[model samples]
Each structure stands twice: as structure tokens, then as C-alpha cells.
Target chain A: MTTSKNTDMDPTAEPEEAAIAPETQPREVATIEQRAAAAGERGAAAVADAIEQGEDAEKAVGVLYLGIDLGTSRTSVSASNGQRETIASYVGYPKDAVSQKLLKKRVLFGQEALDKRLALNFFRPLEHGVLKSSEEGTPEYEDNLRAAKDLISEVIRRAKPRKDELIYAVIGVPAQVSINNKQAVLDAARESVDSVMLCSEPFSVAYGLDMLDDVLVIDIGAGTTDLCRMHGTMPEDADQITITFAGDYIDNKLAEYIRETYPEAQFSIEMIRKIKERYASVADEVDKVVVDLPVNGKPTSFDLTDGLRAACQTIVGPMVDGLSTLVSTFDPEFQDRLKNRVLLAGGGSQIKGLDLAIEREMATRLGGGKVMRCEEPMYGGAGGALKVAHDMPAEFWEKLK
Target chain B: MTEMTTAKAPAASALSVAQMLHLMRMEVDNAKLHGYAICCLMIGLDEFQTQAEREARRWLMPAIFSELKAITFQQHIRGLGLTREHFILAVFPHIGVKQATELSEELLAKARELELPGITGGTPVTISVGVGHNSHPRSDELETLIEDAETGLNLARSGGGDRWMQWRTVEDELEDIRGELDEQIREMRELGPGEESDAVASWGHALVRKIVDAFAVVEPSASLNQVRSDVLAIVSSEVDRWRDLATIRQLSEREKTIDLLERRITKLTGSLDQTESELKRIASLKAIDTGISSIYSTVQGLLDGEDNTEAKREMLKDIFEANLALRQ
Candidate 1:
């Protein structure tokens, strides 16, 4: 392995495998005696050590609180393995009546539940974050909560917490989760955990980033683009705003535009999103992007260069306008700080020309400052919670519940 | 050993810490997704869960590829450059737990078209989250913030599944009462137990005085008895679980003879018995008679609790002679 050259040497073989040296190795008695004695002692000691370890291996149970991040698209559960993430967040659901009878369970969770969604009801429970009926105390609303409760409970049970472990949680709420809807989710969550607390989605990202200082976070989400301003320690009414113009907005616009251009183009919303993700750009690059769209049940190609950019840029105007005002509300001096220190922490920041666009707009307003994106958007929020859990004194947790 | 190459994980379960991170990030990207906090459960599935090398590689390969993904975090460890965030970890799930936690695969495949802001690649970004208040509350908004996230994770564990959550629960109500009871019970630890009960029987103690002692009757018990009682209680409450812990510990030890023999045969995974036999065989070579074998026997005897310490020391000389005789 060291030299690339194949050096053939063998001890448990004939003379050809290994050359006998002119000077043979003298099997020293004294050294062999020493090793024998040492090995003897070591073996005895190893036995004693093993016995001791066996006796001490009994696991002691302690009360541990857990936090779960169950996003519509994926799920993550946290508990103490030194600190959080002690188990994989997963649930298992029976695929059919036969499966249900065989398994004697309704649903599984995490990867197990997710991978087999097609065979089950696959209820995400939240459509655009609230009951589609848009009313409170309805049956669909209640069924959703019940389903959510079942899923969460299974995920928690998977964590295998002690009977003595005091489990509590704080959940991240979408910025636009209506007060009634938020309360309903909280009420449902209340059934599963010992305690529950709610905070904003973008704010959670902001909090994760330690962006407590003046900063702006534009969380570009599926159904919405939320702009939040953090001044001092917490977000106030004027500090945050959620607009229905994020990824989903772009998808809808892109679908409409593409459909307008090619009436026979066979495509779903997902296809357009893929096309946008591949070719959509806000910067002035007019390169053509060719994609296959199903035409009358067959595939056809189209060049969507200008249209992609136009669609991708749709959310920018509203988001920029909202964040601009939020920035201006801060003191003039702090506005400069906020603009320059603009921290784009959500999925929206992944847009190719987003940072540039924000930088350009902010530069015109506050002279010159840069907009930065978080490196790990996936864990940006959870990592913040972990950071808080690790850094804060244990006693601090005692007072929060 | 077969030299067949295998991917770093099984095709079915591609779970890893890095994948968890990517998924959580994708949740943050969802447009309609709202939550108070987030939680991520990262399992070191590589070394622990992998039953076969082929399956192990399959699970681990995606992570290597994800790390090699041309965007975001890949810039830090390799290829293009990006600065480390002071080696910090972030928790971003507190606000959106109430809504959008149960993002479907239907959604993930079409996230970009759905205009879901979070999903960058085809990989879905859903986290099973629950919302709850911290049992140990803190006034610092940051502490409260963490408490909310922690509670959500707890709920997720307990079945606050598929979707996000953001609120306190009925269980929270009970814990509040328990917290108050604990506070009251703290004052009682000061007054000793059995002595107070004795005084009460003697008609010299007040009811309040006895109540002030947390365990007036049990406190006077012997320490050994206390330990036995505690162990028994653990076994009783947990039933087979606490009892099975002892057995699992026993299995983790290397004292099993079969295991030793296998390790010796394989050259990498043998146990103590094989080592003893190998040593005895080597010691029977020329110039060395059975003297080295005697030493091995002595060592084995010591392990068997032989009390002949002085005789064992003297036997060392004969063993040394046998070793020297073999070399010459």
C-alpha cells in the first residue's frame, strides 16, 4: 500500500514466498519469556476489566425534553445524544388494510412513512399552513390535528425517552400561520408533549443565525416569501411581514407563462419548478434554456430563456418592497447596519442572482453594503437552537417552561 | 475476502447526518411552511446501523456526494472556498411547527415548480416537528426560543407527526403542576425521615412537621437497603428493560470462548482461548521445552483466582530458562 509496487512477501508459505536471510533471526528465549509473562498478566487484567465494565453498563434513565422539526417536505426529531438528534425522526404507516392488519398500525413516520406515502392517505395536514376551509373548529381542521398528533406521538416514541424524562418542545410556525390556526396547531401539539411554544419561521432562522442584532431575513418559501427584521432581541409587529410570493408564486407564474407560450406543453407544476431551478436567473443573462415538455402525450422541446428569468423575478419586487420598508423603520444609523448586514437565511437565498439583486437595491438605498447567505440553510434554524441549548446555563432551561 | 466494491449504503435507507441537514434546510425553503422552531435527529448510522459493508457504503455514498454537491456547504470542505461559521450549528425550527411540517413527496418532487423556496435539489426537506414550552423555562428570549424548539421535538417524538406544530399542550399543563409540586417538595428534604415518623408516633411531632420531611419513614433505612430498594424499584417500573440492561452488558464483554476462537482463526477477530493455544504452540519449539507452557498455565491460573502468588513468582525463573534454552 505504501509504495504502489507489489512487494510479494509471505510468512505462512514455502521458501519461494519469502527469501531466507543469510543471517537467521535468533528466537531469543529472554524476550519470549518476557512477552509470555506480559501476555499472561494482560489477559488476566483484561478479564477483570471486562467484568467491571459489564457491571457498570447499566443505563441510567434521566428526564430529557425533545424538540421536533416536522416540515411538510421532511421531518427531523431532536433529543439528547450529548445534545439533541438522539434518534432518527421516522414513522411507519400501514400501506393497505392488509398491511394495517398485519402491522396493526395506521402510519409510520420519517423515511419509513414518507417513502410509502402513495399507498396511504398521505395527509400533510396543513395546506398552505391552515385548513383549506379557512374556518376554525371544523371537522377537517380537527382531523388534520388528529393526524398530526398521531404522527408526532409516534416520532416521540421513537426517541425512546425515559418515563422520568420530562419532554417539552418549542415549534417553528410559518410566519403567516393565522392566530386561530396557530392556536389549533398548539392545541394539537399540547396533546403530545409536556409543553409547547410557538415562534415565527423566518424569525427562527434569524434566531438561529444570532441575527438578534439588526438584520433582515427573506425566507422564500413555497407558498410565500416572508421578510422579517430583527432589531435588538426580538421581532415586533413592525419588524416582520409575510407576502404570498415565494417559490410557489414563481411556479404558478412560470407554469402560466410557459403554458401561454406553448399551449400544448404537457407539464405539471413540478416540471416547471425543475425548469426554473435549472434555467431561471434574474441577472441579465439571455442564454436559451431548452427543456422537454409533453405535447399531446409526447415530448416536445422549447427554448425558455427570457420567460424563466421573468417568472423568477416576479417575487423579487414585492419582497424587496416589503423588506425595504422594514429596513427603513430602524434608526437611520441602524438602517445602514441592517442593509449592509442583511442576512438572507432561508431557501430563497439560493436563487442564483438573489444576493446580487438585494445588494444592488440595498446599495442604492444605504450607499454600499453586502447581502450574505447562510452556508447551511438546512440546519440554520436547528443549529441555532442547539447553539442556545449548548451555550446557555442549564438553569436557563428551568425557567423557560 | 471478496474484492467486490459496494456503495456506501443500501439503496433503501439513505439516511445520514448530512442528509438530515439538507432536509431541514429544505423545510426552511417551503413558502407556505410555518413553524416556531425546528428539530433534527442525526444518527451515526454508518458504524452502528450498517449490517453489511455493501449496505453501509450505499447509505454513506450519498453523503459523500451531497458533500460534493456543487452548492452551499460543499464550498467549505472542498473545491470552491467558503468560510466556516466560526464552527457554529444553528436550530431553525421554532416558528413553522404549526404549519407545513408534513410536506409530501408529491410536494418534494415538484417543490421547485410548487415554488417551494426550500428544496434546491430533488431531495425533500421535511422535519417531523412538535411545538411545546420548555420544562425548564428561561426569560432570555433566546432561551424561550430554544425551549419552543425542544418542546416541538419532544412532541414529534410523541407523535406530533408529518406537519409542523407551534403551541403548548395538555401534557404541558400536567408538567406545570409537577413543577409546582417539586418546588414544594424541596422544602421537605431538609427534615429527616424515620426520626420524624417516630416522633409523630411518640406524640411529640406536629402533622406539619412530619409533612415537611419528604421521606420521614424511609430516610432512616440502611444505605444498602436503600440501594436494593432503588434497584428493585427500577426493575419493577421498567420491567424487563432495566433487567435486560444487565444482560446486554454481559454480551458486550470479550470473555466468550467461541468469539476468541473465531478471532484467532480469522487473524483479526479471535478471542483469549485462541491466544493461549497459539502461545502454548509457539512455546513448545526447540531449546525451549514445556517451561513457557508452564508460564502460560500460571497466567491462566491467576485469572482463575489462583492464590499462589509466591510460587508463581518462582516459576518465572524456570520459564525464563526454557525460553533461553530454546534460543540457543
Candidate 2:
């Protein structure tokens, strides 16, 4: 029988670097081609191992792996077929007969739904990073369930899976999603994929980056900021936290400041969102934020730099406070390692100067620290989830299916 | 006589003219943001060089600086500065003009009350005070903030020494802004008993009112951008529907009003675009756009020794446990 290593070992075991601990050294360089070849070799080896373990090896050939980050604002997917897609997580149905006739479609998705919302019954199925599971038997709850299913199916369809291929998906969820919520997500995803598993969003990010240990992952999505500390092991309940102070909160705060400062100007949440996405920062010298809103039916310009900065700064204190708690409570030997490997992921992580701000806070609050921004803020979770789907063994897939 | 070169706590704590200017500029933003008030007070000892003895000036200067610094400790002052014969004090989180005036009077009283040895009687070493504060924080009247203080000082000195005066801007800025808004509303209303422009006027009035209502609550939770965009969407759709109606009938009056309303709508949309570009400019200040792409298409094992696999798996299990614990 073929056996694979399953014991804790130094990740950096190459003889040239044997003396250095894995967490202290930079990751080894592997070219894209090299990594791909290794992955292909591993895939074949894993299949052979499965066969020896009395599993069906032939069933794996046409199986596709999908990693999905189902978020409140946007749903992103990275698939084995080399397709990555992100869409606004919204679904809309025609409001009435006349509008239905005009739109010529029963339902719309993403930006289309957002644009045509006036004539459609718009639904955002997820809120704060979970399926909006309302009280059962209520129409609102049923509608949310339907919307959630439709949204998942639509996102899968966007992956362009071949009809002959079996689909296996791993979805990244909030670190502390309820069991009922996970079941609801699994139920929604099962309709479209052959097998599915849910993983913590931050864990998925860490897995994707190959920083599985001695790292603190902060995935700041629209609805929540999830913090996870990895110590060469999967993070435990004590190693994670989910705070609601995130992108959505920043948007609301920015909008509020604009409203108060320019009482004669008219604006909307979408506009405020644009402001947050484009101009959000917590730095000493960010450029001026000036935008125009209609006033007395005339366009008037107002500077919003102060308000945007203030709103953006709101998350820093809370996030650093959370980071302090996570860092202080870790094994004292690994606490410094955890602080030094702070990883920023998710859409909210795209806010400018946030990594530096967090790092600065960490130094003051935790004695000293380091923070690294994920190369892909928008797709970090989705990419990590995809990695999870790929790493999952064939037997787990079969069992889950 | 107080020693001129002697460093007292308040005068020693004083920043340079440059530093004080910088601090005032920084605090102006905070004052504007939190809806508080700030004012700069410029006090000049009236013609000290020509009036007092060169030896007397050394002791007199420190006495003047000391008293000025002492007054700031009594008020909500942010910083105090000395430039030659003049002293500038910046007061912040200001209560109002009345409080500022009372504080200014106290400062003047304290200056005249100073016990100077070189000069006697006739309100020895009289000082002229000038104060300037803004009612609206958004106004960039900062360049003239110091100038206003200077002007008020000039007025105080000209109107005889030992007195203080507050500068009143020649034009009422808030009133001017209101007048401009009213004028625009009047012009839009003048579009006259027509359907398209009237609808535009109605939406316009409603939009303005909504903006006004937004000012009542400045909570970060309130999303004014959403309200603005929603109103714009409605107005734009209405304008589109009206344009189609006018196009089909070719009613001259309807077309004319539609044209006028369309221009207004275009103007409104143009401002949003300008605002977007402005926001973009701010965004460009940071390294935000260069999002890094991950190289790994699939999950790869850690670069660990063979012996560590079990520990790695154990960690993964712990993560699952933490995640699962949420259900519990």
C-alpha cells in the first residue's frame, strides 16, 4: 500500500536551509511551469494512492474543482478550468406584467439586476457573509432561499463547466457561520455541483497563499472582517474573530458625512459605494475627495476628504484591537510569528494604506508587528477556496457527494 | 521687570509663527468636520520699538509674551506664537463669537493689567487685539484668516490702542450661498406651467429637500450616496420617458421644455462625473489599483519536512473545529 506523509515537519526542509525554521524563511521559489508540473504529478500520484486504497480512480478524470467566495457584495469563483469570474451577488425578478414584457426576461443577475432594479423585485440573498436564513414559513424567508439558490446556480453557470464534467466546489464562508446556514449554502450549491465543502474564508486565503502556518489572515469583506491566526495548523475557534466593521460600514459612514456637510446636495448609496471603493484610505496625506451632487437641481461640488478618511479610520482601531486579542492569546512562543505574518485579504482589504495603518497600530498596541497585503485582494478568498477544492482527496469528494 | 530672555512655561511652550500656522491649518479641517469653531487672535504691542527704551524693551517683551501665554491657558486655545513684537494665539473648539469676544476682552484686560516697570501710567504698554473666526467650516477663507486678524489689529490700533476688535467679513458667505440656491430655484421655477420642466422642477425640489434632510443625521450608517443615486435614477428615467413622448408628438413647447430640462440633467450628470474624477484623484494617492494575481491554480502542500504532515493536518482540523464550533 502506498502511503503519504502525515506528520508535522518543517516546511523548509531543503538541506541548504535546514537550520532556518519554516516561519522565519521566505517561501521557496517555484516557477509557474514548475508548480503546474508538480501539481500534475501530485494529481496522478493522488489518483494512484486512491486506487491502492480501493477507490475508483477513473471517476476523477472528468471532475472539475471550483473555489467560490460567496460574499455579501460580490460572488467570485476560480475554477480548475482556469476561469475566474466575479459578479455582484444580486438577483431580481420582474415586478409586474408590463415590466416583464418590457424586460423580456423573467429574472436578471448581478449588475443587470442592479441596473434594472426599478422594474424588478431585487434580492440580495446574503448579508454579512452568510445566507440570509430568516424565520421559516415566512414569504421573505422562502424568497431569500430561492434567491440564494438562484444566485449560486448563476455563479456556477458563469464558470462554464462542460456538460460531461463532474463538478466539485469548495466555498469559503464566514469563519463563524452557523451550522444551519452552512447546510443552507450546501443545499444551494449541491444542486449545481456533484460535491461541495465549506471552509473558513480566511483559512482558504491562507491555504491559497501557502502560508498555512504562523500567519494571521484578516479577510475584510463587505459585510464582515474575519481574522484567523494559523500556527502550522488549521486555526481553532479561539484563533478567529468576525467583526461587522467593514466595507459596508465605511460606505454608510462616508454617505452620512456627505449628507451632513452638503445638506443641499442629492446622492445615493451606489455613489457612496463608489467613493469608498475608489477613495477609501487611512493615511496621513490622502488626496482631496471632491464629488458633485445635484443641489436645487444644479450640480454642486463638495470636498469629502475629511469624512472619507474619518470613516476609513473607524475600522483601524477595531481591527487592531481584534488583532491584539488574537496575538496576545496565541502560544507565547508563536505570538510574534503570528503578529509578523499578518495577511490582509478580501475586497475591504483593498482600502489604501490599510496594511500600513494596521502595521502601525500593531507596533503601538502589540509592542511590534508586520502586515502583508494579499497580492489579490478581490480574489484571495476565492482563490484559496479553489485551492481547498483541489487539495481535497478523492475519497472526501466521494463521501461528501 | 520680568526678564525678557527668561523662558516662562507658556511662552516657552509657544510654537514658531510657521509652526502655529501649520497647526491652525491642520485644526481647520477638524473644526470643519466636527462642526466646531476656531479663531486666530493677533495681538501687537503698539509701536514698542519707538515708544519704549531699548533696555526697557527686553524686560517689556518677555512680560508681554508671558501675559499673552497666560491668557491662552485660560481659553480653549490650541497654540500660541511670538513673531517679533506680535503674539498670535489660535483658539479651538470655540464656543461662539460671544465667548470669543469675552475671551478677547479678558486678553486685552490682562495685557493692560500687566505690571511693567519701564513705563508707568497711561495704560503702560497698551496692546491691540484682532480676532477672526469662521461660521462655516467648508469655506477656504484660511488664506485671509491671518489677514483678517491683521486687518482687525490695524483697526484696533487706529481706533486708539489698548482695545480689541473682531473682524466681520464684508460679505456674508452663508447668505450668499443661500441666495445662489434661491436664484437657481427661481430660474427652474420660471420654466413655467409646462409638464416636462415642471416635473423636473418637482424632482429638483424634492432632491434638494432630501439633501437638506440628510443633514439632520450625519451618522456613518446613513448612506447619502444611495439616496442621491436613487433620485438620479428616477429623474433620469423620467426624463427619458418624457423625451420619448416629446419625440413621438413633436410638440414644439414640449420639445423646448425637454431641451431645457435635459440641459439641467446633463449639468447634474456632469457634476457627478467631475466628482468621480476627483475621487479617483484621491484614490490615486495610494497603491490600490495594482491588485496582485495569485500564481497557484490549485492547492499545494506546505514546503515542510515529511515529518510535519501530521501537524499540518492537525492544524487544519483545528480550523475545522473552530469553524464547527460556531454551529454549537
Best by TM-score: 2
User: In candidate 2, what are the lDDT values of residues A211-300, reduced to their tens digit?
Assistant: 877899999999999999887766668989999999889989887887787777788888788778888888889889888778887988
Residues B195-314 of candidate 2: C-alpha lDDT, one tens digit per residue: 654565566667657765775576543476676667667766766666556545555765676677667656655655554464455446443332212223233334446345676566
Worst 10 residues of 1 chain B by lDDT: B290-299
Q: For candidate 2, what is the lDDT? A: 0.68
Give the top-scoring candidate (DockQ).
Answer: 2
In angstroms, give how far residue A294 of model 1 lies from its true place. 3.0
CAPRI accuracy category, model 1: incorrect
Each candidate's chain B TM-score? 0.21, 0.43
Candidate 1 whole-model C-alpha lDDT, 0 to 1: 0.46
Q: Model 1: per-residue lDDT, tens digit, A217-320?
A: 87665555667787654565677787877766787888888889888888886578667656767887556788888888888888887777888788767866
Supply every candidate's count of residue pairs whose N, Cα or C atoms clash at under 3 angstroms. Answer: 169, 35
